[model samples]
Target chain A: MTGSLIILQPGHSVVTDLGRTKGPAYGLPVNGALDQFSAKAANILAGNADNDPLLELTALDFRMRATTDLLIAVTGAPLDLTVGGRESPQWEPVSVRAGEVVAVRGIRTGLRAYIAVHGSFTVPSLLGSCAPDTVVGFGLKLVEGFRLETRTTTAPITQPHFGLPLFRLGITKPAFTTNPVIDVTDGPDVAEFGDTAGLLFTTQYAVSPRSNHIGLRLGGALPERQLTSEVLSRGVPVGAIEVPSRDELLVLHRGRGVTAGYPVLAVVTSRSLDLLAQARPGHTVTFRRTTVAEATATHRTACLELERLRQTINTVFGLLGIGAGQRWYELSPASGA
Target chain B: MAATTTTTSQTTLDIYESGDAALRVVARSGDAETNWATVHSLAGWLAATGVEGIHGAVPTYDSVLVEFDPYLTSARQVRAFVLLGMRQLDFVGTTLREPRRFEVPVVYGGDYGPDLDRVAEHQGLDVEDVIARHTAKTYVIRCLGAPAGSPMMDGPDFPVPVPRLKDPRLSVPAGAVSVAGRQAVIAPAVAPGGWCVIGQTPLTVLDAAREPLVPYVPGDELRFYRIPAEDFGNFAGQFLEARP
Candidate 1:
């Protein structure tokens, strides 16, 4: 069956304008979705894959016109949502009447938000990812008058009966505190710094406003460098904290510079990357080393738990005899026995 | 005073865990050539031996980073495998494949290359002489997958290695041929950069729409062909078509 389409008009949102470009002087920081896991979860709620295209709004204005009833979920950073001028909760699936305009306003808490609609968000796909790689201008950035096509599912619109807070399921909740403790493992070049440097990492460091997805310019007592000579350029992965000089500690992220001459002191594990992504300027961050075994174990467990959650959602939908698009707000379980 | 000589022997391979997902193998000595050769040899051997659970292996100038599925393989096991591979590396030759030669056309001087004269002055040579020297030398590609497939080529063999610009521009136009230290690169797309621009290439090193998105691979030899600004559009179109 041909799915319905919704035309989304982008408003004054920061997600529309931030990304990487070659020019100016320093490399552009890829700042888009801060909580990728939460964004993925929001997509899954809309019956789409984890990697599907979603609107990433960063404390800005975003508007959408419902061509038809849409099964949409808004996750990540609490933002005020108004449909026909009424307050709506940020996390749960909401039903909108045809042609009603839905608007998202400045984030009251948190730094980023994700809005996912069922079916493909008709935007050009580059590099097999609908997600924008701001480091390279490859995805659709929401701009005024830009129309995004989203297929409206015919499945009965279902609102979440479960009132559980989204954060309980490993998603970040809107909180006032900015200081976050991020876990890390020693980088390949960590040995370049003496034993004192390792000790210094455990101490708290302030996150500078200058931080972005490319890398974080850490504010703290600069770690000492034993080897001051230039390091041969090498491939860098996300969460790599490299110290180029004695004063600056550059914590590399997903959209980091392709190569760097600095010596990397530590790398944040995959499980904790989301936390680092949400870190705000002036946030206090501290690192604690974990054994290779511990880090691997944590990642494995997290993956398994996520898979289990998906299965649970499928079972719940099946038991209700109501397919994904069915909107039933009733909390009663499917009848049996 | 008596003349004395000291010789130090160390392990050819040193293994360290790069977080939980990967481990790094670094050569003890700080020699660039030796380190690169060793890393390439090690990577080649690992591919040939069919190490289980290894996602992919990338060799840099001084180290080889091996990423493995954390679920399937432990970092300890990967490190052990690398150590074992180092022991058997003698059976495998340390030589890399011969580099493929390609002529890259460049529009030097004027706006395309604002720093050409500065680079020339730094080398105590005329701008034309600088172009001649740059084009004369064959450069080896160390890595090719930077922003928009920037080819990191080895050298101009200058007496003094040039430093990056103290104040980098926010937007450096694509196809910009730049040099920093002993390395030269062709910017595949417009991005912020600090490298001194010596010229601009007509070739698009990376094009997403094209198959084999990145044109140059590691072990490719590059020579620059100086072209006038008027021919840039033609050369760019031809370069795009040449890629399959």
Candidate 2:
């Protein structure tokens, strides 16, 4: 675990953590993992802290060779994961020996996949995060021949399967359905949108090809503006559904700039933002209006479920004599809604 | 006594719910200039108060976006807390501090300023006249958003509003001073911008090591002074600091 993980083929890979929690005041964008649930689950399964830095893979195949015995977890999108040409299960922790090649290929569903190692990636952190922000222009981009170093010297678990009552915790996958109906609350400018707000829920929007970490551009129906006056540039939150003057309707994501000028029609709920992170180009999506009270309630329920799973994992790992994950839990308890 | 008396009929506040975890508060009742100043004061007051679960307050022209943890505290609680805080904040007294002043050195025209000649031609003024007019007034920083430490300032009494470029540049050089709609900004980082660039500053505006990151905070006053092209290279990597 102390050795390096060499990237043989880097396919749009980058290191990401919980990102900067304190930079919005300085106009710095919070560029964390798009799918927070999946990223945290991967880290939990890999015996790392929930907010530890991990590799985020998108679309294409990724190949990395481990230089030390390590326990890693692959979560998020469904992908063909293998170690030394042998098939391995994703969303579950698997042990890999030193000098073994792991391939994560053939992304079948969703847009991104996460690879979380037991010790976590050792990279430069800015504003207390390793997540890359393209606008401010900082962070490490995974390239071919790039080597990622790890800190811990010993692996938490040496084998994938154990003799003492094997346990598996089923997690709700952050995957997109054929046409997912996402819930949203009123945006700051929702009143200004007038009757045009109805068009957002009524029409099925196809995720445009230009979508990236910054945001998703939906190419179905553009909500017409009722207030024609130009709005002053204001702070923008993640999952804000903005209606620009022209072109496709935009849904700002975590990688969005701290502020924007377009008037926002609605904002995707916290739980719905995780689902939207799995959205890919050409996927059809529909929006459903909800209240802030209801949205917060739903997110609270989701957080309680994750907390239950973490407790269960702690007990299971303790029974298996794995102390690394429990140490992380004791050090820093998970913080979320 | 004056603080309590001056609070009546001075400002109106509207709190808008942004998603589940954030709230946007817009202040009105005054002119555009005072409204933005009020926003800065409100942002500072809210951040200073230890209202549980409130993470950060981002201030813009006339509004403040307060981001909070939904699980720890609900929007209802945050809204109530903000309302209470507003009443307690003395807008007419000590809450608002004196504006910090800074003089930014810039090299105008030629290669340093690609769009200088075009801006001069559109305004029907000579290059020297454009520089003189730009440096004439003491601008106030309204907000900071996007491209790191770029301060969105308002001032420099131009005859008419200068329009943005039809097509924005792919990458505007760092410290490039640009203007649009009578507002001016010095680009802190090389970023894509639509505002016409008329000059460049050699001083570095963003440093991760520096506390506050940027030299000046919102509501600070800035005055631009002309520096020869030769002096621009001399000040490379030098941070733009506030006048002591």
Candidate 3:
């Protein structure tokens, strides 16, 4: 049995407004997500594919109506949960009846949060992704008075308990005291930067207020260059840390333009991209060089762990006698229903 | 260092890792035609090879950026696959299909293009000549990702390339045609710009509400035609009203 769930469409309000331009007049890309990792984890917990679409809400400006009672798990940045204005706990599965309004408000720990529905949300695909390319205006931006229709499935609200997998992966948050270290490789026109400037990237830098999805503006000693002439515009990608001028480092984001003329200092690894995305204004970020072998190993390990988490959830459900064909399963431990 | 040799064919391909997740294939081609052709051929070969972990490959004028997930396929493996794939590419310069052409009507000089006189004086060409040289040439679209469908075109090899303003204006109106260095581009949406404004196009280059969203694609040709300011306003109004 499947049911349709309609999430309210967003109003005209933008979740993360565009940032101001800086010297060299470069525009900063506003890149943020409600719970970057949790969003990914929620899909796995719900037994959905790793890349399934999830609703990312920042500071609680989201509401959805349940057309079918479905299992859901909320992760990342704690948000105030309310069903018809009634308060609920964060980071847990709750039974939501049909026609009930699920409301979420922002929390102080993080600006963004992730809400994963058991099944995937129904939205038109843009550029081969359901993820909202906010800069390009390709995907749906949830606002007030907006309606979103979801595929309805009559699955019993079976909450699969999951834990944060960070510790198991030997991953720990970098101490705020230490400079935020990002790994990078050489880029096109890297030779244009002198040896002294190349060494300058090893030093500490601060994330400026002028950061966004398009790119992050790093505040640090201006790296000197051998050639001051302009470079022809070319393709740029997320994590392409480009130095358009002296004293600034522009770290590209997911929505970065396809081409650029700026000289890139380094490319951030995939593991640290989400961390960079969640960085707030004026936060300190550092850079460190990593060997290609080490970067590849880290990326492989991360993907494996994500796959393992998905398997664990499926195992838990199977043990409880909740097969995929069952319409609804009981949450409490019991004999045959 | 001893040079690596290709097994399938003698065509030499230099493989360098861009990062842990990406690799670059540098072909021995210095001229524009050879460079672009190599990029296009390599791009086609990679697509046919069905290399695992590759998300997509974007071919530029001289290079191709292969985006892949390091988790699925290692950089070393991808590099080897690309090298093997390159050997299969039959070197042929296929003429790229012509994209949709647009005759963009513009109102040059005056408020729309405040720097028209400056450009004309700098080149020692009269205003009419400046407009003629700009409007006469059929510009090829090299790329169009910045500011949502802003076409970066190769302008007529003008005697002198106009430099961008030292301090860019706060905002340049949409459809404002500008030149910087040896390139000309139209402002898709109203935003701050550094290019020297020479004219304004009445056609909407980027409209998110529209079906295609972007009006121009790479390889498209754009020709600018001069029109009165009043005519520009009338056409712009009609275009906006036509949209649902």
TM-scores of chain A across the candidates, in order, are: 0.78, 0.90, 0.73
Per-residue CA lDDT of candidate 2, range B51-115, in tens? 77887888898788888878889988988887776776644432567889999999998888999
Error of 2 at A302 (Å): 1.7
Model 3 stretches with alpha carbons more than 4 Å out: A1-37, A59-70, A77-94, A98-111, A134-136, A153-180, A197-201, A318-337, B1-16, B24-28, B44-51, B93-95, B98-102, B169-173, B207-217, B233-244
Model 1: CA > 4 A from native: A2-33, A82-87, A151-176, A195-199, A245-247, A320-337, B1-11, B27-34, B37-55, B68-99, B233-236, B240-244
Which pairs clash in model 2?
A: none
| lDDT (Cα) of model 2 | 0.81
* Interface Cα RMSD, each model: 9.5, 5.9, 7.2
True contacts kept of each: 0.37, 0.67, 0.28
lDDT of 1: 0.65
Better of 1 and 3 by DockQ: 3
DockQ of 1: 0.31
For every prediction, compared with the true complex, DockQ reads 0.31, 0.47, 0.33
TM-score of chain A of 3: 0.73
lDDT of 1 by residue, A24-119 (tens): 111222334556666766666555666566777655567877666566668776568876465666655555556667788876445667777766
Model 2 residue runs over 4 Å out of place are A1-3, A153-167, A324-337, B1-10, B50-52, B91-94
